[model samples]
Target: MKKAALLSIAMLGLTACSQGVQTMTDRTASPCGDKPNCVSTQDNREKYQLAPFTLTANASLDNIEEVALKLPGAKTAVKEGGYLRIECTSRIMRFVDDLELKIDGRTLVVRSESRVGYSDFGVNRKRADQLREQLKQSGLIE
Candidate 1:
């Protein structure tokens, strides 16, 4: 009985930590939560807000996808219309973080958030910055 209860609790914890794409919309990536574990181009909070990537004339969703996939532990999980979702896992703890991108006219909106933690130790912000630099290097974004 004790073993069964422990198994159930473990499953519940994993389920909570594996949530994905909770607040995305057709036109934008999801907003950052009140926690510091997120950063988004659509967020109004100074600490959580990042500038949307300005797509160059030659840039496409394919270019963005290719650039994003080069990030550490990044894998494309969803691609539909102008939206793309990439799951990035931490190397040690294997914590999954959702990195979402939405094409909006000449720009790419972005949101990166941890699934379960209150603080990601700036991991989400660093991931976004790394992606931005790669996009710029590839001439995909200005």
Candidate 2:
């Protein structure tokens, strides 16, 4: 019985570790690995590449930050200059995904990456799409 309990606890620990977030480097998010767990607008690698969106005349850094903060699982966000970093946590297991956005003139570059795991089941991509839709709906992006 004790061994079974220990095994269960160990399994839970491993599960949590599997979804842990890694340290983000600099203002730009880290590059995506060979895994499919990350998506980024700045990436040139075809498998990890995503198209950036253009900001509208009404858009500003504050509006962009607001849209990201309104995300369902958004836990924390920080903005500096033209860069915004948001941390979104999963509902159940509480896994974290780091999303970084940088505005250059009218273009918004985005990057979303899982801290752990080799795959996010496309959640990262879906989240970026949702953000884009929100920005468009709010007239922040064109």
Which model scores highest in TM-score? 1
Query: lDDT of each model, Cα atoms only?
Result: 0.87, 0.83
Give the backbone clash total of model 2. 0
TM-score of each: 0.83, 0.80
Q: Stretches of candidate 1 above 4 Å error?
A: 1-29
Give the RMSD in angstroms, all C-alphas superposed, for model 2. 3.0
- Name the 10 consecutive residues with the lowest summed lDDT in model 1: 20-29
Q: Write the residue-wise lDDT of candidate 2 on 16-105 in tens digits.
A: 777544545544545678899888877789878888799898888888888888886885556778888889998886888888888888
Segments in model 2 whose C-alpha atoms lie over 4 Å from true places? 1-23, 27-30
Residue 65's lDDT within candidate 2 is 88
Candidate 1 residues 35-140, lDDT tens each? 9999999988899999878999998888899999999999988899888989898888778888888888998999888877799999999999999999999999
